[model samples]
Target: MRGAHPRVVLGLHRSRYERRPLTAALDLGVRAIDTAFNYHGFTAHQRLAKVAGDLLPRLTLSTKVGYFPGPDGAPQHSLAPSRLLAALEQTNQALGRPPNLVFLHNPEVSLHAPADAAREALSQACEALADASRRGWCESWGIASWDPTPLPDLIDDTTPAPCVLMVRSGLLAGIGTLDAADELTARWRPSAVWGMSPFGGNAEDPVWKTVDPRMFLQEPTAEVSRIQAAFRVAYDLPSVRTVAVGTDNPAHLQEVLQALDRDTDTAMLLKYRKLLRERHAAINGSEARP
Candidate 1:
C-alpha cells in the first residue's frame, strides 16, 4: 500500500452488515481500510475474512485490539502478554491473514486508571505489540483514541515507537473541540496521524447544518459541501497523513471522495483553517487559536 498524504482510507467501523461497498470503494480507488477487533459485536473480522482472499493483498488493512466483548457479555480490557497474543492470533485466523497495521484501541484507559497500574498495562501492551511486529503477525502497530493525554507517555523513547496514531479529528465546528491535533503535531512528528471521525461521527449534525461555507470558502456556497468543509481542516493539518471516512452507501462514498479531492486545494485549505479557528475561538470565548 502507498503511504500517500492527504488521502482517504475507507473505515469499516460501521459496515458490519455490508462488504460489497468495500469492493466498490476499492474499485473507486480507495487503497486502505480501518477496522477494529470489537467493531460490531466482535464479528467485523469474520465478515472481512470473506473478502480478504482476493482483495487484502491490494489493500492496507488496519485493525485494533485492547477491547472486546467476553463470553460473559461484558467488555474485556487486557494488555497482558498472553491475552494480547491470543487476541492477535484469533484476529489473524478470523481474517485469514494478518493485518497490515494494528492499533491499541481506546488507550485512554491509561488516563482514567491509577498511574502505576496504567503504566504497567501500557508497558505490557507495548511489549506485546513489539513481539507481534517481530513475529510477522503484523507489519506495524499504533494507538487509536479520541484523547491525547496518554500519547506523549506512549511515544516516549523508553516505549515502543508507534508508526501511526489514529485519533478523533475533524472540522469540529462548535462541538467536541480539542487542541490535540496541534499538540500532537508539535510533540510527535515521527508518527503519521490517521484521523478518525472526520465528520464529527455525525454528518447530519445540527452544528454543521448551521455552518455556512460562504463565510470561509473562496468560491462561497458553490465550491464545497458541508461534509467537505468539515474534512478539509483535518486533512490540511501537516501531521495528518490520512483521514478514515466510511459509508455504507457507494454513492455517498463517491461523493466523499470527490469532496476530498476538491477541498484539499492549498488556497481553500488555508482559508478554511483560519475561519474554523476563528469560529471555534468565538464559541469558546477564548482569544487563543488552535
Candidate 2:
C-alpha cells in the first residue's frame, strides 16, 4: 500500500457507473483508491456489483461513514450504529468483495479524542464498526481524522487492535506536516495518510481552477504548482508513510501527476500557495453579491 505506484484517493460518492475517473486511473497505473460508505449519488455503489474481485484485486478500497445528510442542514451523528452496519452491508454487496479498510468519514466528533468527555460517542463509533465486522462487512477497520492526538484514547483499549490513519484538512494542513511527531511516529504510525484535498483546501484553492466541477475530476488549480513544491519538501524527509492524492478526473489527474513529476518539494509549494490562496480568497470575498 505504501510503495510502488502513485496512490489515488478518490471521494467516490453514490455509484460505480460514475467511476470513469477511477477506471481511467486504473488504466493509467494508479494503485491505491479510496471511497466511503456514505458518498451517495448514482454510481458510487456500482463497484460492489461490478468492480469487485477482478478489478478490486489490484487496488486498495477504503470506505467510511459518520457524515450523511439529515433533514435539516445540521451535522448529525445521531444515526444509530445499526444504520452504520447497514451501510457496510450495502458496501460489501456493491463491491462483490470485502473492503480492505473502513474509516470514519470526516467525523464531526474527533477520530482522535475530543476535548470533551465524549467517551460515549467514541464507544458507539467503534462499536458500530465492530458490529459490522461481526456481521461480516469488512476485512479490517481504521480511523481517519484531523489530528492523531485524539486517536490514542480510541486505540489503547480496543478488543482486537484496530489500525489507525489520519485525515488532514486538504487546504489547511496542506499535507499533514506534523505526521512526524516523535510520539505518534513511534507508537501509532498510520497505514496511510489521506491528502483529502487536491484543491489544497476545499476546491477553492487556486491550483484546482483549471478543471470542470465534476466531483471525480482532479484538475490542477494554480495551487497544484505550489502543492508539488510542498511535496518536494515533505517527501524529502519522508514524514508520512503514504500520501493519498484524490484523482477524480482523468485529465485533471494527468495534470496533477504531471505537476508532481515537474517539481518535488511541498515546502516550496506552500510558500507559493500562501500568496495564491490569499489572492483567491480576496477575489471571492470581494465578488460577494451581498
Candidate 3:
C-alpha cells in the first residue's frame, strides 16, 4: 500500500500571526499548525493565544525550542538541558495549554563541541524534552533540523528517539541534505517524518519560474500551477508524511491542499535523485583534481 495521503501543516515561520489565516486554515480543514519559540520575535505563542485562543482547541499545535534570546537581543541556539526545560515551561504558559508536539529546533547549530561532548549534549537535550513529555508538559517531542547532516553520527543506541523528525524538503533540498535526512530517519526511526520549506522560504523566487515541477507528477498537466506541482512533489522528495508550508492567502493554501490528491511519479523522483548524486560527485571530483 502507498499509505495514507500526505498532510499539510500551516507553518507559522513567516506568518503574521493574524486570526484570519488561522480561521482560513481551519475552514480549509488544515488543523495542524507549526510554530517555533523564536518566531515573531519570540512572541508567536502569546500572540497566537491572544488572537485565536478560541480556535486553538480545534487545532493540532506543534512548536519548537532551542533558540533563546541572547543578551544582545539576538537569538542564540543552545542544547543545555536546563534551557530546554525552561523554554518548554514558558511555551506551555504562553500558549495557555500544552502543545501537541514540541521539537528541539536546529540543535545542529550548537553541536560544535567535540564528538563525545556533542553526543552527550544532544542526548541530555533530547532527554529533557522526553522528560517534559512524561510529566505532561507536551503530548510528545520531536526534532526539527534545518540541516541534519551532523545528527546521524551522534545518535547511538542510548540516544532517545524522537516521535517525529522534521527536515527541509523539496527540489531546493541538496543531495547531501536529502541523504542525511534519510540516514537520520533510519537511525532514529521516528514515528513520523515531516518536510518543511517546500518553496525554500519564498515561493516567488525566480528559480520557480525556471523549473517545471509538474514533470515529477504522475500525470503532468498544464492545468496544475507550477507552485502547486512543486508543493505536491515535495512529499516524495524525502518521503515525508506531512509537509509544513507557510502562506497567508486562503486560496494558495487551498491550492496546496489540492496537491495531496495528485500522485507523484516515483520513477522520476528516483531518476532525479540519481542525477543529483552524479552531479554532486562530479563537482567534488573536479575540485579535488586541482
Query: Candidate 2: deviation at residue 75, Å?
Result: 6.9
Error of 1 at 232 (Å): 2.0
RMSD of 3: 3.4
**lDDT of each residue in 85-202, candidate 1, tens digit only:** 7888998998888899899787665445666666666767877887898999999888787666555554444566567877776565222223555565555454687878877777
Off by over 4 Å in 3: 1-6, 286-290
lDDT, candidates in the order shown: 0.70, 0.52, 0.91
Whole-model lDDT for model 1 versus the true structure? 0.70
Query: What's model 3's TM-score?
Result: 0.95
Measured by TM-score, the strongest candidate is 3
Off by over 4 Å in 2: 1-6, 13-19, 47-54, 68-75, 78-80, 110-117, 130-136, 146-161, 169-171, 174-187, 201-204, 207-224, 230-238, 258-290
TM-score of each: 0.82, 0.63, 0.95
Model 3 over residues 1-290: C-alpha lDDT tens digits?
12322398999998999999988888788889999999999999999999999999988999999999999989999999999999999999999999999999999999989999999999999999999999999999999999998998898999999999999999999887899889988888899999999999999999889999999998998888899999988888898999999988888888888778888999899989988888888988842111
What is the lDDT, from 0 to 100, of the residue 252 in candidate 3? 89
True lDDT of residue 118, candidate 2:
48
Error of 2 at 140 (Å): 1.6
Q: List the pairs of residues colliding in candidate 3.
A: none
RMSD per prediction, one decimal? 4.0, 8.6, 3.4
Best by lDDT: 3
User: For model 3, what is the C-alpha lDDT against the true structure?
Assistant: 0.91
